[model samples]
Target: MKTHPAAHEPGHSSAPLTGFSQCHLGILSQLQAFEELPALQAAAAQAQTIATHTLALFHDAVYEHHADEERELFPAVLRSARRGEEADFAEAMVRRLTAEHRHIEALWKKLEPAVKAVAKARPVELDLGAVEELVRNYAAHARFEEEHFLPLAETVLRRNGNHMEALGLSLHLRHTPQPIGHI
Candidate 1:
């Protein structure tokens, strides 16, 4: 239930590139912590505290980051690609990235309950193999986005001008929390 600093910030108006870079750093740190879990020998309360923080980081930040790409940026990229030499290239990349998202989500599902148990200070067996796989998968995912998807996005969005801003705005709106009474 902790608030993330990046949570309600206006993403499009702000620097999306910097935001993504920061997000990637945060995710890498959290994944490092996750990787360390198997080796941790803390008391129940300490373990629970660590797990709770990890869960919050994933839920609040990492997931939102993913949504920004999937919901806003990816669509913009597709539209921008509709009439370029990069058209087919963009399509293929988006498909690969989307599939990677699914793989990442599936890995999280396998990992969540064990993390939840740790959060509650309950004894639970974690799948170490799954943990290793998730860590490796995320590392690869980050690299792919940073090296491939991002450069392409920058090129396409740059040509489209305001599309980048629109993407930023969409990301900002998506992260902004809705009032409880709002429809």
Candidate 2:
């Protein structure tokens, strides 16, 4: 009977980037209050399924985001940056993000086995604490991008009015499943 807001509301400006962020937020909120719902422990265990999906979504998103920056955004901003401390700061961010993506990928690789086991209802399982930690870290990463990286792209790297829209559509199309019978 419970449904997401979007499920009930039609004609919304739906996009997967925001959708995934909201999904993670919903999952995290559920996990935070999990102790209060002992009867829903079985449902909580379904978080293993959510975790697997989250990892795949992030894997695709981050790879595309990094590629977008490397291919278009970063070079544009680098040219506009004041050629000293500001440029250095942007470079630092690029380095930090590149390293962070690798770290996140490594963490997800470790998490995959645990999630698979949980999905199978096997005795092997992910530590709730570790999963929470990973989620929190990713939340911070998303916040940084939304707060800092996106603004930079909008102001400094935007060459055309439609570049961001084009990028958004490209990312949204990735991983979207096609109907099997659609000709």
Q: If scored against the real structure, what TM-score would every candidate get?
A: 0.70, 0.55
Off by over 4 Å in 1: 1-46, 82-84, 178-183
Displacement of the residue 94 alpha carbon in candidate 2, Å: 1.3
Give the 10-residue window scoring lowest on summed lDDT in candidate 2.
166-175
Q: Best-fitting candidate, measured by lDDT? A: 1
RMSD vs true structure, all candidates: 26.2, 23.1
Candidate 2, residue 99: CA error in Å? Answer: 1.5
Candidate 1 local accuracy as lDDT?
0.85
Error of 2 at 120 (Å): 2.0
The residue-by-residue lDDT of candidate 1 on 13-100, one tens digit each, is: 5567689999999999999999877667555667788789879978887787787788888889988875756988888888998888
Quote model 1's TM-score.
0.70
Clashes in candidate 1: how many? 2
